[model samples]
Target chain A: MKLPRRRPASPKKTAVGGSPEATRAALLQAATAVFVASGYEQARVRDIAERAGANVAAINYHFGSKEALYLEVLRRQASERIERYPLPDPAQSATPEAALQAALTMLLSRLLADDQRGFVPKLLMRELLAPSAALPAMVQDVIAPQFRQLSAVVTALLGPRADAATIQRCTFSLVSQCMFYLFARPLVQTLAPQTYDDGAVARLSAHIAQFSLGALRAQRELLERADA
Target chain B: MKLPRRRPASPKKTAVGGSPEATRAALLQAATAVFVASGYEQARVRDIAERAGANVAAINYHFGSKEALYLEVLRRQASERIERYPLPDPAQSATPEAALQAALTMLLSRLLADDQRGFVPKLLMRELLAPSAALPAMVQDVIAPQFRQLSAVVTALLGPRADAATIQRCTFSLVSQCMFYLFARPLVQTLAPQTYDDGAVARLSAHIAQFSLGALRAQRELLERADA
Candidate 1:
């Protein structure tokens, strides 16, 4: 049987070499892999260009610098996947739990599905540990907006009294719950040598959603308890 | 005040210029910085040695290969920190929440205290994002045993009814809660701009402890709810 075609690439960039834009897109695809493998500081433009099947000068021509290219790769990876897997339709259901779970499911599914998408988390983790000079810009342009949106969604579900600090903490907790699998894979596999396959990913996704729901529910309960 | 005297050269590797062991230690230290800055694939033995104030031959003479040196750096960092910060004494607490909170506090304190100790999370994150040839050894020797020990502690606290999967999920949640601050500092700072200092770290520590306790407590409640 033919495998399902992967999700369509985000409208932002299409196939490489199809046009001038495609060549830039191709350079980004190649750069993501190289940066994920070697990291931004060590990833060479020559290798990225070669991987993209473009001239060495193509990277500079398209992105101006290796740093610029790396930032672009981060943006493309984060923004495109998020857009492709749009947040759950809020109109579907009224409960906060339902909306929260749908949003989380979308996020987790994207994280676990695409192989090329693996580089995004890896790249972000690297920058987090040892931020490059470009990190501020990347965070401001790409990461901050996504997080702000997530916090807003979570806060709305949580209601007005949730407070900015509580909302921020909850957002961190939700993202961290999802990210543990990707960021701590080696350790997880080592700790429970039995559980690293597709089966495990399914279980993990379910558990994360359940765990998050429980936490969110508890927060709501606590608020009710306090008011009572 | 005079800076606390650097730990006198340990007998394990005196600072004598010509000793093979000293050369090996120096190379590892240098490699840690290089790897932290440039990451594994892009870090060079020459640059590492230069950072260590040693000759390039020092790496080849002691470690035999760059990959070996990288692995050794990770090993040394993990082992040294583990040795320095002994696990919390289990006898200090009776409740599972108390025991786990104690452990979490110790782990997070070490992870965020200062640059020297903080490097463990940074280095581990880099490897997680981009596994190199050396990653398996690094994980086995450094990450696994600690996680296994922590998992056991968590299992005991959660009780026998908690299956391996439940315990593992909880462990991942607990760790992610602890490590998230260090791993997501830039993003946190960018989004929350005003709250990224010691005050935030204090809030994070308290929040993680509470969050983790709530999750673990919920596990027990879930088991109770199922039985009822």
Candidate 2:
């Protein structure tokens, strides 16, 4: 269902001067905070506008609608993080194993970095847990490419002998080990307090990398033996 | 913080007659539906009582408060599922490999069961995502024992040479693989439909078991080499 087309009855003056770019940027920033604090369903355009210091009509003027604004917020945050923490070129590492470690470390750095970009993980996780109209598009446009990249790395690590299904499961196992920290932060903090401490990102990435490398190498050996 | 003390000013006649056990059972049944539907914060005592056909006073008399009632619901559902799907005795399996697979199957069965007992997983997941007052106790009383059981199986597989931290990480890796299906069902359904279909529990159990076994065996070999 489309959100009601809410054109403010009377458009108010721009709070951040008459710069459309500034207004749009401010709206996106405010929208991120509002969306993160209260998920998609509960987030109010009025709140987003007020926080942005832009009029409600400014949201419609800049992003067309709240859903569109939300999509932009999600898309921008994802791209920004990927740009900041892009996967290492396979050639950069000594071996596929090192490449895998680099890839996992990069992914974990994105997922676990406790910094200003923190809102992105929280926002994405909210979308995952209680999905909104934006989920399908977000998965296809944003998540699928990242998933495919990781799959390619897994395929390389598993070698040509591994079946397609096996490659996919291995890819998921690697990703899940990383994503679980995002999905179950509270549980992890409660159960393994040390694992969730300041060194969590490094410690978890190393552990997942080693653990997954073992699984991948073993599976490769098994497939090789079967072929022989 | 304690829930405010609320005693119905006028205790009405019991809906399912004067039998305390009958009223209590009805209240529990109704409360599960309400809690599962609305979650802990939004669920109303009046609605639970009305659905049970009992008076509000019955809730107070039986459960003491809404928080207590919610805890009882969580506690009972957990115990019931565990009773219904207890982990296999380690002695029954020929090896730790078999035991690990058996344990994974048991866990996936409980997590993925598509039957009347569905409310428990949904309820438990809700608690995990948006924790309430009952979470710490639930983790301790319900989840920790199961975690310890899985830890034992993992330790048996990893061997005595591995350090405590390595064992803990490996245990979490195994669990995170199984739980990814639950926590990210929508993503799984969207990304790989086959993995979440009718045969999901079996397929997932097999994949996680094989993958985790490979990792465990590899770690064991690595540990052995280190000792040598």
Candidate 3:
């Protein structure tokens, strides 16, 4: 059952060399597909190995177990998102508003942009709904850092003295605006097919930035008024 | 494997009498669970019927097939949400601002409220991700109408003269905030475990309402300034 298939390991021939590195890369790609499709309990290790045109022993040798292989897919996916759409360094923008806008733009790109691991959102979303052991790593390694980054920009935009809860809520609000595009893709595709297009993403970025900044400024004024 | 169990349908005995209505209800309950867990493709009629303490023929007798049963769950789930948390009647609010806030409140409540059928979000979420046959009914019967209603509130808040795109974007922004509380529940739970609690829901509700309204009002003022 673990025999390598004569056919290519997918269209890209990710396992071209059949070397350990190539086999590991091939396994990650195949494991991601299988995991996203069948989830944790149902996904079979043999299927993943077959998809990668490698032996099951390779999965054990390289990743130790199926859980470790799944974790690698997630970790790689998280890093790739940052690499592909790095948040505009907070300092790069000339003003607080620009910084926020830049962040939103990059975020929209990261969420909307599809790469090799396009299934990451669905994979993570499943875990979110029905948490497994992975929920902690996802929160700590990926989500926590991203939320903090957004919170910092939001705090700067709202003024340094913004209360913690308010900053957190604001951060959640801003991230959700971008996240909805990816998270609710199926429903959006069914109802409004045009939203995922690049043009739409760009437009959405502008609207969210302006709308968020607009709201923050308004909230600031209201707070100041109450203070006065 | 599809044999009818002789048990009394323990617990509520949703199918106690084996009456058509009771059987149907029982099937819906059990189907909701299986479908939410395994999705459309993976869910089996035998599992659902057994869970509901009925037989396979009862599924055929009551809902026609697994697909029909799944569709009924979505339709009922959709209607139940509207019934449980109907959008605030438009006339009750003296102003558009109040109308939008009320609507946001309703949406958050609908999203966050867990009842006898707390699995609705997860069920709908899986469909939204993979989207088998039920996507159309979900969009048409549930999601679209709600969006139009929110768009109307956004239009009123932005003033009747606001263009279509701005209103649409604003509506998406507002809905995403609430949906995030539901959509990103896993991540939210991991980081801000307080969000789902009653106190957090109320506070978050207030924050989203004000944040959205504040942004709209600020945008209104900016538009006016530009016009002047």
Candidate 4:
């Protein structure tokens, strides 16, 4: 489906002219569209402002600079969206398969529900491809913490005997499974010629969960084999 | 480390100075760098020619159009690179673990070693991220055939008992393990704080092989459980 065309920002006013916060919100939304369309390096503040229907100066007033605005856009879109997917409560589930399923479901739902035209993942993917000076801050403040929390959940599920490399690979596999749909969607669609509808999504989720559980189970086996 | 900047293309002496074939090769190489840097949508033939040290007219003379040049780059760089990583000989071994390990080693080596300023994977990643009109031809000519061949190897290693989904997931896991490293190297470096030197490469290879074997073993167990 084609995304909505970019619209010029209206002056700071919601019908009767809303608050500055409203204007700021509008500007951020516009920034998301512009960034997704042109990528961070190519996105211009002027276009973003125009799309928001706010004055060009509004971006400076609200976000301080284009870079700051971009960072804020990422913070709002990527981090906040991820936060919506609450981590699985450990007290409720003791089984590794249950915890793994919960985590996989949360991840798949988040990836699938994100409807912004290439807003979240594309931004992150771009940063991954050609990192900028600001990457350390982004990684530290946003991404790393989430992954660490994920690792904790996974560790709890796998119990005390899991080795570091095993944990790392499992973590990589989980993230990679979710990302495959996003990063490889075009290629998959081209090759598979199947629409990834709800049915397809269900099938994919089940496959990923099973694949992950099996990997974890096998890790235990390998550990036991090593010991023997 | 920063990659070496593009060298100016020497002037054409004869059809052989760059014979028409030499001219074509130089153009494609230059086009690869430009495509990698700017992506297909934004890359210009003039820039490619300048990068290759040839006149803008040379592109028209050689490839006929910008799109043709782009396709040529994909064929030469992406498709040919895939071709280079030939399927592991089936007679070499039979165990699923050994077969997978051999295939993964070949895949990872090709992926990591070909990271010449992100030429090959970057191009493929771009196509994956945003498919263009030329994608079908690209996929048919370059990507699909290789994937099919790889899939057949995976299917054989998996034995006759594994169903289609299991085969697919295993194939996905193998590719994910290999591609994720190149795709997420920046994040990996940031989080791991370890150099991806020879030792790290060995560790990573071991990690992928073990992880993959674990997944395959898990798949077998799941199939058994289901059957029971």
Candidate 5:
């Protein structure tokens, strides 16, 4: 949830850089919204401050500059979302299917989460679609590791004998299915509104898992046939 | 290919409304470039004119207004791209697997064709991510029909016993795999540059086809087991 809007630092407060943590939190929230809506190239510092109900001086004092503020927003949102729906360790599950399902459940829940107008995925997706200086670090720090973990889970499902290309395609296929749900939410909402109801995401996730396991089983058959 | 830039109305030619068909084509081409790069709201009419090497009046003359021009660009690009890589009729294929593969081959080819910066898919994706007035008509006229055809192919592969939900998820899984390549191209390029090389897409497409087939077969086994 948004911190109380407009918690501007008062001069009566401690010296510069002494703004309450709430004000700092508020600024990051507003920056995510502004950047997602207008993009980095077009977003203005004053607009972020206005939306946050904080003053430009507060932004300057806390984050140092607009670019610094944008990076902070990216880092904060990524860390928070990852925190909220943390990936389950495969060891926590009994089977690869269960592990994969757990990973997907966390992912779908994050993508479908509309809390704070879905600021987390929106800001992250905007960066992916339209990159900024922040993107390299974002990919390296957040995305790459998330992908590697998912890749490991996928490879586990495919078993040790699966070739690299086969593993890569299977991994990509599963991720793409999940990404489609997030990336095409607007279109899907119009096309299939019922998909968003209570427990609907879990149902959808179940279907994708079944769909994928089915495909993997079939692919294993083909590989076996080729080997024979 | 982009029409010659800035083919202004020659004074030696006819009067205002007498803009040639070539000019109209150029306007449509230029409009797509501008719209994709800047989006509909931020796109400027004057910018399209400069790119087309035509005057602003030529836009009004050929397409009536900015909204009209945008619509024309959407329609023209959709029609041309569809024309370039037309979907095959299912009747021509001998089996469901072949039919499904044919459909996916066309779809992925269209998505991966980077000629002209892969303009068609990029423009259409930008619209889908950020839909406008043109989106509904675009979906109705262009997208919905394509989906329906693909759905039919998927349903056939699913067999007559498959229910609507099963068929829908299967269809979506197949499409999501292809759409992922188009949508997350930048990320994929960074992550797996090998995927973009000659024959690489064909290999990817073959993997998706096998993956879907595997999943479908596995799903069938589940259904049979449940029945037993």
Candidate 6:
């Protein structure tokens, strides 16, 4: 039986070269498409090999197993986006507020800007809803580090007044606000009905930054008042 | 072909009386389980009928068509939750702050409180990610009205300074904050590792209320300062 096809055929063609590197690259690309279309478990290794025009033996030779291939796909997809939209180094921004805004802008760009054709965001979202065995590795390798980076920024913004838990919750708030755009895109489109054109990421980034910074500042004040 | 079963058999037994009303209720319950498991298009009327202990012809006799049955499931689920967690009557609170807090608390309760076994929340989350034909009607019947109600509360809180678009965006911010806990539950669980016990809803509601109210107040102050 033909598996149900959800995504359009990828325009990217596997390289014709019979070299090992070329075959491996083709396998990764094919695996990504199959994984995105069929999810991790339903994705068949045979189908991926057929799509890549590679031998079944090539998969095990290159990646050892389907699980390893999936992990590689996730790691590569996540790293590529992070490299493209890296948060600014701490010293780059003049102030914590500036740093926070830059971080939100980059984070929004990462989450919403390239979401069309993006695989990691979709995979991670699926992982959130019905987590697979890969979730712990993902949280460890990707999510935890991102959380710590955001936590640092929240700490700087909230200053010494807020405790660790407060910082953590505020970090969740900031990330959640940004993610809502991607996860709830359909509802957002229906309600707002605007062109999510090139300017959308920057525009949304501004709104989130303004709202979040204001909240962080307010939280700090409340904590200060309580201390007094 | 044996269909993959995702959910355990619902404890709700079809009424033995074989009355039309009883049959319809049973179908709704079975359809909710099937729809939630297989989604809209893949869900089979035959399976739903068997699960409900009714005849396949009974579905058409009661609800007219599969499309109608699906819509009825969505409608009933949405309305039940709304009725249970209706937004504050506008006059119920003396201050907009109190009103907004009450609204947030109720909204959070609605979104997060009964979500564990709730069919509607699961179905709605599916709608957000992979929208089906019923999306427009669900948006029109359920989402639009909810947006308007939230808009009213945001308008009252933002005072006269913020415009319609600002009010709309702020409303999205408020809602996105509450929904994050639901959509991102696994991530929240992985990072926090705490039991989402009974108190989780009220605690999360308090955090969102504080963060959002603070943002709205700050937004108003910014606009007021600009006017100065």
Colliding residue pairs in candidate 2: none
The residue-by-residue lDDT of candidate 5 on A52-150, one tens digit each, is 767789899988989888877766677777777776787889988898888777767777777656666666566666666767776676556667777
Candidate 1 stretches greater than 4 Å from native: A1-79, A89-91, A115-117, A140-142, A156-161, A192-196, A199-202, A220-228, B1-29, B115-117, B193-196, B199-202
Residue-pair clashes per candidate: 0, 0, 0, 13, 9, 0
The top-ranked prediction according to lDDT is: 2
lDDT assessment of candidate 3: 0.78
Docking class of 1: acceptable
Model 1 DockQ, alpha carbons vs. true complex: 0.46
Residue A223 displacement in candidate 2 (angstroms): 1.8
State what share of the real interface contacts each candidate retains.
Answer: 0.53, 0.64, 0.82, 0.73, 0.74, 0.62
Measured on C-alpha atoms, candidate 4 has an lDDT of 0.71
Residue-level lDDT of model 1, residues B139-218, one tens digit each, is 77665655665687788766667887788788888788777776777777777777556655566767777766666667
Off by over 4 Å in 5: A1-27, A37-69, B1-23, B57-62
TM-score of each: 0.77, 0.80, 0.84, 0.79, 0.84, 0.81
lDDT of 1 at B39: 70
Model 6 lDDT per residue over B125-152, tens place: 8787667787787778666776787889
For model 3, what is the error of residue A132's alpha carbon versus the real structure, in angstroms, after optimal superposition? Answer: 1.3
Q: How many backbone clashes does candidate 3 have?
A: 0
lDDT of 5 by residue, B158-185 (tens): 6667788787778878888998898877
| Evaluation by TM-score, superior candidate among 4 and 5 | 5
Clashing pairs in 1: none
Record all residue pairs in model 5 with backbone atoms less than 3 Å apart, i.e. clashing: A6-A53, A214-B214, A214-B215, A215-B214, A215-B215, A218-B214, B6-B52, B6-B53, B7-B53
lDDT tens per residue, model 6, A58-151: 9999999999999898888877876776667877889999888888887777777654366777777777766778788877866777788789
Find the candidate with the highest DockQ and give its number.
Answer: 3
